[model samples]
Target chain A: MSEKIKILYVDDEPDNLVGFKASLRLDYQVLTAINTQQALSCLNNHQDIKVVFCDQRMPNVTGVEFFEEIRISHPLPVRILITAYTDVESIINAINKGNIFRYVKKPWLESEIIAAIDEANKFYIANSMLFIKNEELQRAYNELNKFAYSVSHDIRAPLSGILGAINFAREIDDVEEMKEMMYLMEKSLKKLDTYIISMHDYYSLQRGELKIADVDFNKLMDELKAIYTVLSKTNNVEFNVTINQNEVFRSDEVPIRLIFNNLLSNAFKYLDKTRDNRSVDVTVEVQKGIATLHVKDTGVGILGSHIGEIFNLFYRANSQEAGSGFGLYNVKSALLKLNGQIEVNSVMHQGTTFKVTIPSI
Target chain B: MKLAFIVIDDSELDCFVSRKIIEHVDKSLNVKTYQNAELAIEIIKDNPIDNSEGLTIILLDLHMPIMNGFQFVEEFEKLPIQKQKKYMIVVLSSTRNANDISRILSYNGVESMLEKPLTLEKLTSLVHRVQQGLN
Candidate 1:
């Protein structure tokens, strides 16, 4: 223990308290008390005290009584009772009641006291670790329950729509109507395909270890432009990219790619059809050890009330267009993995802008 | 007086299919579609059909942004007793969640819960059941 483990000792006799602190002060941070009242105050002041030792025969209150009182107040610190050979029966009762961890003899041997302190510290560490693990497991279980519902809803909704379209097409003889049905079917299939791809991104980002390397924003932006150019042309929305970087930025490329891909897709997907001039702009700046990126789009912006909940899993703000609702959630998760932050600014029918910052690994 | 049908679902494709199948089953029927639950509720609150005209069959979707199907039913029940009698609500959803199914069924305004992709047979049977007072 580089830093001493704190231990508290309480006894009625002033000589006993001094002797205990003198013997163990070098190895442990010993806080001694002359009475149960002093011991309670010490516990309140130093919440991190790992082991509490009390003399069984004390003025006003006994060791067992103090242990029982503190059992509810300061439950974490392991309690030990110091008693004589004559008080064996009471010590055994205290141990059975789970009030104390163990007992030290009246004339304590230094070795026995050291052994008790070591064991108590180990128990404290193990208990805290178990508490943390249980919390993590509970969070994972809750997420899995949500995943189950989202999977069935997201996948089934589109599939059932496609099936219904097919059924309707079978009865109609009009060529133009048949083509319309085919278009609807294609749209549903595309939504399903997008959902499946993002689901893949979700799993990989969750399980995969971060592979950090130098992130060249220029190359990344070029690749994104190559993929989204055709889509931008078809929708008649201008796509612009600019990068200003003089420093070497390092991070996990996969998550950075996932984050930008989702953001850009959303930028293109929600443009206002009534607007004649629509544009999506991207700008990246790296300075010192941080990279700041912005994706601004001229689209039908999100409602003000929906700003806070957009990142929630399976939450959709706009029902007019078919969306998997996993895009922003995936982006948030990936940013969390990389210790990054994202912020959004938008106004209805005006536009939206997303800003992100990442620190070099 | 002829019966009328109203479909309130967020999905445009689902609404299209439902309207087509509903019209094909009986060309004489009148169908209205709403992509938002709030707009549908507003229409009902503003101009509830008269009981002497005909019964209105409302096919409501369970999942929608802002106001969901459950909230819509609650709002519908808040209307006057005579106005409520002019329409019958049937829940339409793609969700197989047991709790959602049971909870929506518990609403007094909801007649029955039907799965997604409304077919000609389902519509025909529903109309027959309503006509004979067997629902």
Candidate 2:
């Protein structure tokens, strides 16, 4: 059995105190206090005491008065008033002041007391858990705020560098030189777009307002493939999509779009420049109630060690590759919000594949 | 006589970009770039630009390592009215926070707040606005 829950009982009569202890001592760690002063003293001594049962009639001070005193010093310990028919007015007052969790008459059932203590213990545990969780959430918010400031400062320098080069290129009258500069400017602008998109995703997710809707998986995949078709053609890479299940996928399409967009864009961006066979294959299948999609690419694969932290914010696998390092982080965050899962497989020189699973709702 | 302008920003690239854009907009405009607020303040106080001959426009960056835009403004307010009137201050900042924008607008001599990197369209519009105000 688990540790017994502690209970403190205060009564003026020796017989009543003995009877109560004898009845509850086996099930509870019953502590007896003969007077109001002794009850307060007992509470101070045993900090873990969960419930306090006090009799209405006592010398010099009543049970309600003692409860009021305990309320100031040890507010958390649940209070239970033991009263007869005569002290109903005082019992009502105790309840109104929030001093008592419940009341028990003088001729009380052992079962009733046990039930009340059990409920009180549950309340105490739940309240404490909530308090701890709130503290953790507050700490995370503070860390995120600091992270945003540092990231903005770091990114601004590189952006200014790119902007300066663009301006310098504009001053030169040579057409060939201007074309080369425009190419470089386009590359930098892509990086800037990636950074801004990631920042937007991070802030929006932190705000926690993801709009969920019914989405057509087949149509969405077709649209994505069409969007990247021109880029794929320019790079001499063939893209294919295969869907085994043609069911309507009900989830937040926004996050799903973000995840798929980043993954597909990465596949296109990091294609094997020297390889003759440049291709990407996207396949989806449903088993039972779960839908899984696989995106496999013949591209520059990730290292084994770097795979673990690929989803971490600002973590780049290859610094040489033009990337903001926020794409995968956005993908992971979006998947988490959608209650989906992703797994990556890669062989350094061969290729990389990402498998994503979502529950069909 | 050419209009004299001072660009205060920690980023060398941003300073260069702003200077080029301003010069492009008005060919006769004489532009000076400073890497810190303190250096810019020193030049403004020690040897004041001639107000009647040429208008001076101060393009102040909000986020700088040594001294920020708000602190620069506080210090600039202490200068004589003639020296202040010789120049119109335009805040160049990347901060989109409402509180920061509101605070910048609250300052006495600030002409307007502009977001960076300063595009040609924004720079030209700002110049026209300032030129109209001066006349």
Candidate 3:
């Protein structure tokens, strides 16, 4: 066979070792070791040996002792002990403790050894697959636990504030005091509403399978401008969008919208109050199967030390101001799922720019 | 001796509400408000009142951006004992987490915690406790 698995056979008598090798040579890459010392040497030489058959009665060490010793250095090899007695106490102990995967009687049958080898190989594979699956399950469980705790904490904080304000408002009568309390109530209500919307975005991103479509950039730009025009007008800011399409751009429309919405809203939200002519520029181009988009804003930029941590979940870059802080984090997560990438460059009072790239299949 | 009162919170409205409640407990009490913990720490460290005599009470919010209430307490501890200006801190928080409350209460100068929308009853009880401590 072209893909023969390697195996080793160890015994005290030279003739038995040679006979074992001669019998299995055509089916496997058979190796022979005369004593415990030579068996260790063969193991060191053939690291990929899938199974080992060792005689129970050796000169200085029992097969159980030999298996235990090699287990520390070479643990992956499936071990089989060759016992002289029908029900030896030490052989039973070795099998019980998993020191040896199996055993064969002294006058070994050719069919018996072959059967043991087949079963031992399958056991090795199953055990390794179980280890990998366990790790994956543990990781997924930890992520869900963290997300549930954080979502409950964030959503409840604003609601608690609103409830307390309503309780206090009923007993107060002065006009100015009433107006002030109403303002606080409105702010807390708005914060609660914003948090709920962000949670909705999170679930949508997680649940839905990606739908591939030929994205229309011009139509998307018009829609975004129409939606944000009122906000830009109130804040005295302008948005400029340009596109250069060398190929037909195609991707999941939902993720594309999610990325742009987060970036565009942040651009206008943090517009600098000191600058008279505030603007944000968005440019897109596709060439050689790569779609590249850039969003540059003359807004209050992130700090240098804080830039690395901005994409972290619930990380507030500036703790002085109130932001849900999930916008950019969501953008990054969406990009990862789409097999896309993003990079950001920012200067403290000057401006910020983000470059994003996604490939076309 | 003037009874100096300070309220440190991230919300402007929360600061306003606190100032109103502190005055309602003792009308003549000198009350100050800060929208962030850093500003209050600056005022406390750089500029102490000239003729202050009574025990200073601070109402501190736990979840500010740059320097939270716990971080402020850590920084406040570095000040010399005499420069502490006879101040005691009370956490005013919206969090109902028992673990957070128990851990925060273990700090050196933290005297108590009152769940938010700081009510008149809690303020009245605090005033009575302050008076009793004086005796």
Model 3 chain B scores worst on lDDT over the 10 consecutive residues at B47-56
Give the least accurate 10-residue stretch of model 2 chain A, judged by summed lDDT: A316-325
List, in order, the clash count of every candidate structure.
0, 0, 0
Model 2 stretches with alpha carbons more than 4 Å out: A1-130, A166-175, A208-213, A246-248, B1-135
CAPRI tier for the interface of model 1: medium
Model-by-model DockQ, in order: 0.64, 0.07, 0.45
For residues B1-80, write the lDDT of model 2, one tens digit per residue: 34678999766556666776777787888899987787788888998456465678899987664467898999999999
For candidate 2, the share of real interface contacts preserved is 0.11
lDDT of 1 by residue, A1-361 (tens): 6899999999999999899999999999999998988999999999999999999998789899999999999988999989888767877898999999999888999999999999999998998789789899999899989998889887898788888788777778889877877787788788889889989998897789999999999999899899999889999999989999998999999999998999999898898998999999999999999999999999999999999999998888887646777889999999999999999999999899999999999
When only the first chain is scored, the TM-scores of the models are: 0.89, 0.67, 0.78
Please give the distance, in angstroms, between residue A13's alpha carbon in candidate 2 and its true position after superposition: 18
- Model-by-model lDDT, in order? 0.89, 0.80, 0.81
Clashes of 2: 0
Which regions of candidate 3 are displaced past 4 Å?
A: A1-87, A104-121, B26-35, B48-51
The candidate with the higher DockQ, 1 or 2, is 1
RMSD of 3: 4.2
Reference-based lDDT, residue B12, model 2: 57
The sequence of per-residue lDDT tens digits that candidate 3 reaches over residues A56-168 is: 88888988999988878888789999987854877788789879898998889888888988898787668667868989889878878767666666666665566656656
Over B48-80, each residue of candidate 3 has an lDDT whose tens digit, in order, gives 544446778899988666678888888888776
